[model samples]
Target: MLYKVVSHMLEQEAVVEAQNSTQAKRKACRLWGVSPSDEWHGISTMQARKLTEKERRVAAVAIKHRNICLHTDEGGSTVSIRNTATALSVINQLIGTDTGYFG
Candidate 1:
């Protein structure tokens, strides 16, 4: 959710993200210098948008990648694919983009 810190009297606004509505509102109150009774009201929650299939898949790949270095490397995280671009291509195909890149 997006927490909006809105000051109607001062015409000021700030935005923040929190796990739940209450947390967002509280943060917004502090940010906009409002005490829940001030004429300058602050704190409004907006619903967050869900990620699409392509965006989710792209994010998943961007988050983690295998250590595809050739030869015996000292540190290796995962030994799945051989290269990052190759893996991205394969993931794109599975996600229906088929751009051969992180598209």
Candidate 2:
């Protein structure tokens, strides 16, 4: 599962995959290059919470859309689609549902 960890002292946040909050905090600290001693000393006040299902879905859609936008043509050039309808169609296909906004 994905968890969001926030460091109140550093005013920073990170998303990590962990089994629980303790693991999430450890992963986030490692990602930020923070030492365990610093965390214990309250140098980087950290809190970890799991991401909701909706948030996870949104994140997945965003990643997939980014990959779609970065797709390249046969000539090694990036293909850009400027049509809103086409974009909506792609999004609907990725999420496996029609959101009704583009209907």
Candidate 3:
């Protein structure tokens, strides 16, 4: 199963595959180059929780579709428009021209 592990001490988080929260914490600590024992000392400040089915599915879809791009150089670095009509409406708005069909 997939777990979302957050390290308050390091101000970082990761999604890891583990059997349980304990294992998730351990794996997260290893990935972050921290000691798992530090949790006892209140140093690691790690938390682990399982991802829900919906969250998992959404994540998978987002990764597969790449609907949003952050880098300008990557081409299509914009939110994807689903259909031709919607795309035309957006283009018209950007150009300050309202086509009657979309308006």
TM-scores for candidates 1 onward, in order: 0.31, 0.55, 0.54
lDDT of 2 by residue, 1-103 (tens): 7666777676666666679888878876776688756845232478877776775665455444543433224333233444533443344343323432211
Count backbone overlaps in model 1: 0
True-vs-predicted CA distance for residue 22, candidate 3, Å: 0.6
Off by over 4 Å in 2: 39-44, 63-103
**Lowest summed-lDDT stretch of 10 residues in model 1?**
94-103
lDDT of 2: 0.56
Runs in model 3 deviating more than 4 A are 39-44, 61-103
Q: Specify the highest-TM-score model's number.
A: 2
List the candidate 1 regions with Cα displacement exceeding 4 Å: 39-103
| TM-score of candidate 3 against the unseen true structure | 0.54
Per-model C-alpha lDDT, please? 0.44, 0.56, 0.56
Inter-residue clash pairs, candidate 3: none
User: Model 2 TM-score?
Assistant: 0.55
